[model samples]
Target: MSPTGERVAMATDELQATLPPAVTVYERSVYSDGDSTFALVNDADGKRRLYVAGPAIADFDGGTVQGDGQVFPLTYGNAMALAEVFPWLEPTTAGRQSAFGFGDRIGLATPGHVRAVRDSDLVPVFAQQSIREMDRTGRSPEDVLATAIFGVFQEGYEGGFVADADHLMAREDVERTAGVGFTMFTCDPSEHVVADADSMSEEKVEAAFAQIEDSEAILDRYAGETFEAKTDGFTWSDSFSEIELKRAAVKYYEAIEFAEELYGWVAQAVDGDFDFEVSVDETETPTTHLEHALIASELDRRGVEVTSLAPRFVGSLEKGIDYIGDLNEFEADLKGHVAIAETYGPYRLSLHSGSDKFSIYPFFEEYASDYQHVKTAGTSYLEAIRVVAENDPDLYREIHAFALERFDEDKATYHVNTDLSNVPDIDDLTDDEFPKILDQDDGRQLLHITYGSVLSATDENGEFRFKDDLLGTLREYEDDHYAFLEEHLGHHVDLLTGEIED
Candidate 1:
């Protein structure tokens, strides 16, 4: 207090003076790569809580900060844009201090959300009410935050703040989240940890386990010898050792065991009470049958409540499958899996990665009533980008830069070596040519241009441009997109209650 001579004081209890209230924070497990953890923080008594996770303490500790304790160095343009978007984010140059009060969890998508959570006001009703608002009115993040705050201060929602772990891959993820006070958790059973294709068979399942064991042996050898030799002074041997390869055996064997153990632990922590859900990719190769069994068995074993069984559809069948025979077979396979989930009873089948298809609404509606929950994340975010783009082309450029940077970072994090040649030559195309490229039905072209049909330039980037130009260039199309979403997805206010009429 003596720096400016406005006040000169001495504090006997520095910690008490500097620290914020001891608010209990809740985190939900999402995807992580061991670098950061994501969670949704809600003030127990406040109205707003944020859902996102960021880096571990180690990454934050001793980290230098830029202006106002901003830990990471951001470009001037990006910083300015953020400040424009969130004025509260602008702070004095001490660099933002690390809010890594809790240790880090792994995952990618959590960090952005964590940043949002940390910087936002806590609202108690955020969890219980905002989701409904999101479902019905299709509220933006800002809108949700505002609603949550109003509810909390005005005694709106009373069930405490709720946050969902959208999709998690590991048991430790769940454990870490639970420790952080998250009550909702959803496990993703789609990732195949097996190394070889031959492990799909019963005999090969055991062989796969053996192969994993051998692989671990090889990895251990490298960890002990090669890695240590390379680093000399630094060793990640313990980290590698903690990675239980046997637990990563094919979905048929080890996945179920891992799920059982996770559910059991979660149950024990909550006094024999547990609420668990599972998610699968509808387009996963070899299907997710073994993973499904793992989920069902684990749920039964622990008697944990199964909230929702969400299946994420990846690429379109028309693109993923080559021939008519393959497409028919793929559809049959998907139907069979859905049937199995329905047969299990007490499970609600959900669909993920849903959007931009004007035709899939019927298919979604056919099962919508039968399922407990349905979600589409990227679609909404994409729409928001589009909205921003329509209002300001400069914002569109900034967002594009941000997205491309994020994509590059994602590739590096996954250790992927991408071939630029593999990417279709679209640089030569003009604005007029872009429409023709999208209209083509060739799977190869789609694969080359789109990222395995997981993301599309038209839907992602073009839509961004469309959104930027929405209010100005094509107000009609803007209204169309919004109206279409509202009509098909049902009003975003009460997603669970509202049904879109056919």
Candidate 2:
């Protein structure tokens, strides 16, 4: 019995005499609400008891006692109370070991993927097979496939994969990608082709203007007829004499109209929901710059808010010192973009291809404090492979080969060339060649090294070179990546949202 008057034990000599020495017994006072109503006697005799206070205290009452001394109704709460009173009464620790292994060790990238995996009840093999099938068919719906692929993680996942239309030069492509459910897009006005008055002679300028005027005139002439035909629901059973000319005029007008419509549509689509980015190519021709300004003005006139404006000021130059020139140029262009973003209200100025340029962090911090977003992608992924490769050469080689094959395929599809003169040639080279290659040019070196590292980390078959090592390496990389961002780029990224720490 406890010092508080709770019964602690009951004498059972006869049961103890026949039972093994390991067997023991005890008694405990149990309560209900505020009433001390029963005494719990536990023994090898299987809880034989005596009733002392309730109405049926004299009878066993089917092994249940009703009096104050009787123990009645072994409810779950009572069972817990009994266990608390006597620790040995509970199940053994050995019996409580987890039935299934791998508890709480796994982590996920987002929450949405977790729900998808849980709801679908998919295992890793199933998820991998689904991704494989998706890759083969290229028909996976954006949301569904993103969820399935990312759902393999056990924690820190939110459903869906996010991809940005990195640089889109045409309104049609923007609308097309958006229709396919791409939420992030970049519209680059610097790619617009514009007439260059400075580069061309006066006669050439006049001729170009004349051609434009003639085209507009031809369009105006048949514009009324085409509108009338369309409004009247006219159907053509055979080719008409002026059909081609009229069609061209209609197409030209529609293209212009599409541009205006697209500005409004993208603005509405991105408002308060997703990031709509615009990039200005500082290296573009003067005419293209002017055209982009016109587009921005049109967007402003249409009441469409610009969210972010990125300027590509740096190029693949040969010298590290040349980056200083690039920086100066970037600063000049950044001012214009900043002015635009500030005037538009809530818009930010961003930098693109922000990789391997760790030296530019201070510059970004100084100028882009008010900006809303900053993005860096390929750098961290490259660093991830590098870390894994340091520990395992074979795995590194596999990943490297895979990345190279994938990149080669991408290059082929996109018609990208390495500009052999810009890269090092090691054929029949001396020992001095390696150092020369490393010291050649910072910009080119960064590009080559990043690409080479990525290629080296992948396998020949275009698979992730270290598929088996992905989880551990990814975790380590994610940790280091976040730390890097916090230490170096955190000022630009939003600490709360983790989106460019704006």
lDDT for each residue of candidate 1 in 388-486, tens digit (9 for 90 to 100) = 434445544443443433454333312123443443344454433433322332312322222212222235444633222323332233333344333
Residues 12-90 of candidate 2 have per-residue lDDT tens digits of: 3432343345433222233221233233333333322322234333333324423224443333333334334333222
Over 4 Å off, model 1: 1-162, 169-182, 189-192, 195-206, 209-249, 269-274, 280-304, 311-331, 405-502
Per-model C-alpha lDDT, please?
Answer: 0.34, 0.36
Worst 10 residues of 2 by lDDT: 96-105
Summed over model 2, clashes come to: 36
The C-alpha local distance difference test score for the whole of candidate 1 amounts to 0.34
